[model samples]
Target: MSTADTTQSAVVAKLSGLDRFLPVWIAAAMVVGLLAGRWVPGLEGALNAVAIDGISLPIALGLLVMMYPVLAKVRYDRLDTVTGDRKLLLSSLVLNWLFGPALMFALAWLLLPDLPEYRTGLIIVGLARCIAMVVIWNDLACGDREAAAVLVALNSVFQVIMFGALGWFYLSVLPGWLGLPQTDLAVSGWQITANVLVFLGIPLVAGYLTRRLGERAKGRDWYEARFLPKIGPVALYGLLFTIVILFALQGEQITSRPLDVVRIALPLLAYFAIMWAVSYAVGKAAGLNYARTTTLAFTAAGNNFELAIAVAIATFGAASGQALAGVVGPLIEVPVLVALVYVSLALRRRFTASTTEAS
Candidate 1:
């Protein structure tokens, strides 16, 4: 095989172990989180007892840990490259902010209108946008790594700016404007801005400094191939830890209203599938290649549940039904994205042919 073929095989081999079995790890997390919440007396409470301003300290740390590695991998210098792919970039932003949120808003109302807290929670999940985990899904689908990195960075900034205002508009303002029943969300503008700074703000700065310093010290070759490999798994490990802590705190909610998780998941599952189809079709129609297409698709379909969960807990209490809805986003997100990864891979076959023919 050519050197390129060999390198591709090696990369796939490295990614496949964790990427292919992500659903399993998530399932394990669910089981252990539920069991710990049920069986271990005071464990959930103990972890949650250590909180400031209604945010669980452990999950906050976990989210920070999970986020930094993903952020650190971004080549911020290459972000300029996305500007050239204006159609690709524009498509991602439109789908994520406009179409994606509207679809989620409609779904939340249509699916669980009576459960106002949970519906608001679902809306929060949609509005936050995916900054971190979609990188994993994007990579698994052989997306443009550079584009994925750029979009991740872009979305991080976008969410910090847009999430607060858009969230207010959808959950509070627009509903009142439209004469629909408002969810009566109590999150203040200051609180919303602070949450963004506390969460995304820290990691974005840290990741930027880390990358710049690493490159200056060791150079790009060492930073990408050697440095990144060692730390890349931190995100996945922290993700599982957060999942356990989340379900642990939600033990009572899970046990009493297990079906509520399912009910909430219904819109989420539909959201993922529909969002993928929409982004995928849009990418193809825009004449983007397979890599860019899958990158946009994953970016559109995925949720920034870490931010969503944090906002929910900060806005609503940790044990609130809203927080429970935030937890369910990942639960519903993982398996569905895993399935979409397969679908995107299958679609890649067709996309590759079309691109080749056009070229």
Candidate 2:
């Protein structure tokens, strides 16, 4: 075979390996964390103690590492291109900021109203728009990487502001509307701002600088082909590390109330499915290219659970049911989104077939 065919074959094999090993790695992380939590109970506390303003310093660092590589792919210079596709940009903004939160509120309120802490946790997760994991999902679906990066950066900024304001409003003052007692939580805007900056601002700056400096020193082709491919997996590793830490920290609660995890996941699972369908349909109707459509769908459907857990722990105690709910968010997220990855791939084939026929 020609070198071209050989290279294509190699690339296919690599992707297949990734899909096969992805679940294995996730399961290994889960087992290690669970075993550590069960056996070495002191370890979780040791990690948790090195905290600042309700955010664990170690986990915060892990999140920064997870985020930077994803952001580095943005080609900050081409962010203007996202503006050229106003339909996708506007559609994502409307759905993420408006419809998404309202839908979560309705579901959490309708389904988990009796359990206020879990309900509050769900609301917090809803308010925290995803900035990191959506890239992975979009990539899995063969979506526009550039568009996903720009939307993530945009969502990161918007969520930093909206999370605190909306969180305080929905979780605190709005209880009067529901005739429920105000959640006895004091949310400091400054603390939430600090968490957002630590988690998002640091990585965003680092990612842009890494791309620019690498390109200046090594050229664009080397930066993309050599440097990015090496660092890209860091995001997934960091994510698994964060998950382990979260699970370890809350092992007792997780072990004791298995059903509570399920309860929290139910609304979230529904939210993911419904949000994906709506955003996908809207994007298709608006005539977005398949890449932009899938990016919008995954971005709209994803939640920034890291920020949710931070804000929850800061406002409520770490062991609070609200915090437990935040922990469960990631537990349910992995398997559910993994399934969606396959679904997205399957749908893409149909989408491509239809577009080809039309052309």
Candidate 3:
């Protein structure tokens, strides 16, 4: 293997064990954030003022920290390899755009309609896909990094286009099914696009630039060994801290409507299960290898809750049901995806062994 591949492989190995525990840590952080929010109600407001222009500083910081490591790991040269994996790209797009949203709408309509707050919340959650977090998960799952990067880039672009369309359609066109009145979908298409660019695209560009600079200054080995690892924990901590502030801001609503957790969890769990099964089956049918299959599975299973929450708070008010639903998504998604990671590992061994035997 090349030097860069060897370095990446070592980093991936060290991360393999740690990856399984991240969901647990994230879950613990959520609980702590919720408790902190409940006890120290003013904390979120204090953090909220840390912003540039109108954007929340805490959130912007979180996005930067969360995205930096992910961006650093991305081999931009891999972008060239993306087109070679036509099956992975097509499967991800179809499942994410068509099947994923359809299932979420059906579940929300069936399960959450009577609860307008939760209904709107589910709608917001369902519309977004995991743009940032999936990269980490894909790496952990030993997925196709090139494919993951392309999907992340594509999903980021699609969220700008599809979020407003999906939001409006879910609210107005699907009102009969969801039993919710038509309300202005709050965020315009342009607004969603702008937020993605600011939150996702900008940070991604910064990350890439930083990685390139590090490579030039210290070489790739030094960059990966020293810089990337240091950034990982910082980013994770920033994400956790931001979650605490968000929960604190929404403390009263969350405390008052405790049952909303149950309301949101059902649809989220259902969505994860259905999407995983579909992605795996489709990948297998297309005759993809294990790594490609895992990439497809996670790409389908994860939602971009950060963007969703931002748009939700912007459009639906911070304490609106929709915003709450978006917050609740990661709480459900993290643990469920961790479980699916194990599932993917099991499937990988089985599939890889079969492939080896066949060959």
**Candidate lDDT values, in order:** 0.80, 0.79, 0.75
lDDT of 2 by residue, 29-68 (tens): 7777777777895887798788877777778877887777
Q: Is candidate 1 or candidate 3 better by TM-score?
A: 3
Model 2 pairs in collision = none
Better of 1 and 2 by TM-score: 2
**Candidate 1 residue pairs that clash:** none
lDDT of 3 by residue, 1-359 (tens): 64434544454466633464676776777777778777874777787767654467776777667666777677777677776778778888899988888888789878886887777777777788777667666766778877777887888888877887887787778775555576557766666666667667876888789878889999999888888777766656656665665565566666777787788889889988899888999999999888788888898889877677777777778777788888778777877877787677656656755665687
**Runs off by more than 4 Å, candidate 1:** 1-16, 172-179, 313-319
Model 2: residues with Cα > 4 Å off, grouped in runs: 1-16, 172-175, 178-185
Clashes of each: 0, 0, 5
Give the lowest summed-lDDT range of ten residues in model 3: 3-12
**Candidate 2, run of 10 with poorest lDDT:** 3-12
TM-score to native of every candidate shown: 0.85, 0.89, 0.86
lDDT at 197, model 1: 64
TM-score of model 3 (CA atoms): 0.86
Q: How far is candidate 3 from the true structure (C-alpha RMSD, Å)?
A: 4.4
Candidate 1 on 202-294: residue-level lDDT in tens? 777898899999999999999999998898888788878878887787666677788888889899988989999999999999988888899
Candidate 2 lDDT score relative to the true structure:
0.79
